[model samples]
Target: MTDAAIAPRRPWAYAIFLVVFGAAGWWAAFQLTLDKFLVLEKGKNAVLNCNISPFVQCGTNLQSWQGSAFGFPNPILGLGGFAAVIAVGVTLLAGARLARWYWWLFNLGVAGALVFTIWLIVQSAFVLGTLCPWCGLVYLVMFPLFWVVTLRNAATGEFGSRLTRIGGILLPYAAPIAIVCLIAVGLIFQLRLDVLHHLAA
Candidate 1:
């Protein structure tokens, strides 16, 4: 066999990405949680640091019914979920080989998070007509994270042999894909919210 074929499949890069982005997500979520507490302790009239402008802020989102979709603050979910992601990344970095079942579960969780983030993005731009800075930071990390983990799983043949080939081909493009996705979101927000108009005003 060729040397390339004999080499073990180790996704060290993806592990590092997971750790870095996961921590970023955690921090963003933590900030949102703190802001949520501030809203509660001081009431809705309280001023928040994240309230950059009328068009971009967190207080409105925090007070919205959507923020407590599961009968609790959504950032509370991020606090736990991102912590798990960090732990999994640390384990992988330690050279522990995870089972296919575990990979599937992780992929599902990450996929769900991506979907939820997308929904939040849409709601923020359209329904709420405002952007939450801390929540935007969560999206910044989540998009790339979902791509990296899913592509890495496919590259490892966790999905199947066909996807394995495609995954390897696509792995290097994950960052670009994530950038495209973010750009798309930005376009949507700009069209709906007229963000630049607000900025120039």
Candidate 2:
């Protein structure tokens, strides 16, 4: 297909991305909130009986403060953030003309979420030494949501021509991949001692 055809069709792709992201975000939000409620209702006993697998147990991870993250519960953030994303997706789908500044703000929010999700993954894998299946669902949903939003921004010319010109076509994929790698490496190193200690114990 010609570039012209591809360019016009790009918005459809972005729309599809947005819908998928919105759905995933909503699902993650639901799971997180449900898990939190379950924790509250059954307390530690609830988690113990939640033996989905050896590796996937909400109870094991709940023993750590990292599970709560916010002193109360981390799912509350997921519930709020994902709800916002859903609203944005609905707006975009309805052909709303979001300002460039608004898109930039959305980009920043997604970036923050992606970073925090990475931290949570690292905390679960190395520090917590146990995984919450619902938390993993959130991480999985977040990875693509981050990519989709950023891709949509670039394709829709939301980042402004100046920044796009500065980085060119490669920036869209290259920058995010670089950031993900940096976070991955940092997490690996950050949890190294903790992992070792857990192993020794």
Candidate 3:
């Protein structure tokens, strides 16, 4: 009813959202890590010996260098990053007062993760020519988690009021730019589908 009453509740709402999303991300990351390890340990034998179907075959993706993204396994990054996010979420949910500097640092980490996910999506579509379902889940969860957390930080004035003003101004333009980029990337993959199939053959 009153501004003062509503003001106190907003942080709790954001904390709940963050904790739920962070937990989901952690679960997805854990499952993906297990899949990656299974594939690595068993190699080609993993497919037949482990009862993995073609659709769920981690080996299919893991056998390729793209599975690593970097020189090492990608799920390792997910494990560590999501674990940190989980810790932050739990701390906030427990009513811990995070300093402005800490919120800024967390925002930066989430921003970097969102950017990395975009790159992974591009690689999966064009370069890898395949997608892991579990990895897709992580991408879907992380995208909105990043947006919500950043918005929460802005709303709370953790970064400064000016950032919120900037977000309001840019959201309209940013949405369309993101849509167009996604469509363009999808078209590139569609156009290359024939070439990819031929190479596979």
List the candidates ranked by lDDT, beginning with the highest: 1, 3, 2
Clashing pairs in 3: none
Model 2: worst 10 consecutive residues (lDDT sum): 192-201
| Model 3 Cα shift for residue 30 (angstroms) | 1.2
In angstroms, the error of model 3 at 166 is 4.7
Inter-residue clash pairs, candidate 2: none
lDDT of 1: 0.90
Candidate 1 vs candidate 2: the lDDT winner is 1
Per-residue alpha-carbon lDDT of model 3 for 1-201, expressed as tens digits? Answer: 986676433356556766777777777677777767777787666643222333323455666777777898777777788778878877876767888999899989989988887887677666666545566567656766676677667766787888877665554454355456545654654475443344345
What are the per-model numbers of colliding residue pairs?
A: 0, 0, 0
Candidate lDDT values, in order:
0.90, 0.66, 0.67
Best by TM-score: 1
| Evaluation by TM-score, superior candidate among 2 and 3 | 3
By lDDT, the best candidate is 1
Select the stronger candidate by TM-score from 1 and 3: 1
